[model samples]
Target: MTAGVDTGGRAPGRPRSAHVDEAIIEAVLGLLAEGGSVETLSIEAIAARAGVGKATIYRRWSGKEALLVDAIASLKGPPPEPLGESVREDLIRLLSVGPKKPDERTAQIMSCLVPEVQRSPERYRLYQGLVEPRREVMRQVLRQGISSGELRADLDVEVAVAALTAPVLIQRMLRWHPGLDDESLPARVVDTLLAGLAH
Candidate 1:
C-alpha cells in the first residue's frame, strides 16, 4: 500500500485519522464526478463536503493539485505484487486486478479529467508521477522473466510494458473500444505478447 502522506508540520505524535483522510479523498472524487476541475476545486469546498476543517486538509496536503493526485491514486490503490512464479501468471495477475468495468460516475470523471490533464503540463507531470510506480512494477516483472530465461533476453521491456498495458488503459479510461469487461482479457494479452517474447 502507498504510505500515508507526510504531515509535514503537524505536532509530534499527532496521528492522522484514516477516516478523515478517506472522507477528504471521497469528497474530491465526488466533486470531480460532478464536473469539478482542478482549477475550480477549492479547499473550502472540499472541507465543507468532507465535513472537516480547511486546516485538517492543509495538514495533509499542500494544495488541491497534490490532494487531487493522491485522491486519484487512492482509486487505483497500489500496483499488484507479482507472484514471481512465472512471467505469464504475474503479468496476468497484475492486469486482472482493479476496476475491470468502471462505473458510470468513474467513466464520466475520467472522460473529463483525461483531456484536462493532457492540456496542462503540470497536471500531466503529476499524473505521470502517480502512474510511474505502477509501470515500474511491470518493468520489474519483465526483467525477472528475462533473467529466468522465460522471456527473450533481447526483448524491449519498455515496449513490452506499453504493449501489454495500452489496450486495457484505452478501454478503461477512454472507453474507445469494447470488451474491457472480459475476464479473460489479462490472460489473452499475456499469451499474445508471450508468443513473441518467450525464449
Candidate 2:
C-alpha cells in the first residue's frame, strides 16, 4: 500500500487500477524478499505472482528495471518534509525517519539490489534518480542554514550533508551498529556535525 508508480500520462485504454498496481509492486518485493535479483526476475514471474497478465505489467512499466525501480521507490515512500524552523531539527527529522526496526525483508531486498545496481550503469542511474532528490532536500536545508548564518559561511553543503546522513544510513541499511532503534542518534549526529559547521 505504498505509493504507486507514476504512469506519466494517460494511455488510450482502461485506466490503471490502484489495487492492481499495489499487487504488482508487492509481488516484486515479495520475490525480492525471497532472494530474487533483477537478473533473476522476469515479467512472467511477476505477472503470475501478482495474479495478472504480462500485458498488465507492460501497460504499467516498460520492463523489469523500470518496474523494479518503482517498486524500490515505493518501499522508501517519500522523503520527510523538512520544517523551516531550525536547521538542526530539520536534519534530525530527515535522518531519523527510516526503518528503525529489524526488517529482515527490507534489509535482504537492499542487499540484493545494491551490488546489482552498482554493477549495472543503467540500474545505477535509475537508483540515483530515486536517491538524489532526497539528498537534495538535505542540501537545501544546509543552504538555508548558511543563508541565516546558522552554519559556517564556507561550509561545503555536499560534505556537510554526507557527514550528517552517512552514519544513519549505514546503520539503517547495513545494520553496522547495535543501536538501530536509538532515537537519540539523529540528534547526536546533527549536533556533532553542527559543532564543526555551526557559525
Candidate 3:
C-alpha cells in the first residue's frame, strides 16, 4: 500500500490520502500553540503530527522560517467591519472579539521575533504584510467616523487606532490572558478613549 494511501477510500473534495497540505498547516499551528518557537519547531515534528512525509512539507516550504512565515500569515483574519454606532462602540466591538485561548505557538514565535524585528528587516516586513492591513482597516473605519461627524474631526485616527488595540495586545502578550471580557474590556476602552476624542 502507498504511504498515504486511503484504506477507507477517497471521497469528493478529499485528497487520496488525507489532504497533506491542510494537515501540515494544522500540525504547525498545534506546535506553535504548544510553546514551540520558530527555532524549536522541527519539520520532523510537523510531518509526524500531520501524518505526511517530510518531503511533502519540504516540497512546499523552503525552510522552517519560510514555513512558519506562511503559517502565521494564514492564521490572521480579515479586518472587522465597523459597527453602526459611535467610535467608542465600534472600538468596543473590534476589541471584544479575539482568540479565546490564543495561539501559544504564534505567541512564542512572536515573542522571539519582536526583539529581532529591528535586526531582520525582511522578516519585519513580512510581519507588517500580515498585520498592517488589519490596522489600516481600523484606520479607515476611524476616518469614516470622523467624516460622518460621529467622532471629532480633530481626532488623530492613527493614535486612536493604537489606543484601541494596545490594551488587548498588552494583556495577551504580557499576561497570556485568553479572550477578553467582552462585556467590560471593549466598553472600558471605548469610554476612556472617547473621553480624549469626543468633541
lDDT of all predictions: 0.81, 0.82, 0.66
Question: Candidate 2 residues 1-199, lDDT tens each?
Answer: 3334454333777777989999999999999989987888999999999999998888777778778888888777677789999998899888877554537677788778889989999889989888898899999999999999998889988888888888877765677788455567789888877886446
Q: Quantify how close model 3 is to the true structure by its C-alpha RMSD in Å.
A: 7.1
Distance from true location, Cα of 160 in model 2, Å: 1.0
Candidates 2 and 3: which is better by lDDT?
A: 2
* Global local distance difference test of model 2: 0.82
Each candidate's TM vs. the true structure? 0.89, 0.88, 0.72
Q: Model 3, clash count?
A: 2
Per-residue CA lDDT of candidate 1, range 100-179, in tens? 55566777677778877998999999889877888999999999999999998999999999999877666666776674
Q: Give model 2 RMSD, 1 decimal.
A: 2.9
Compare the candidates by TM-score and give the number of the best one: 1
User: Which residue runs of candidate 2 sit more than 4 Å off their true CA positions?
Assistant: 1-10, 98-102, 179-182, 197-199
Model 2 TM: 0.88
The order of the candidates by TM-score, greatest first, is 1, 2, 3
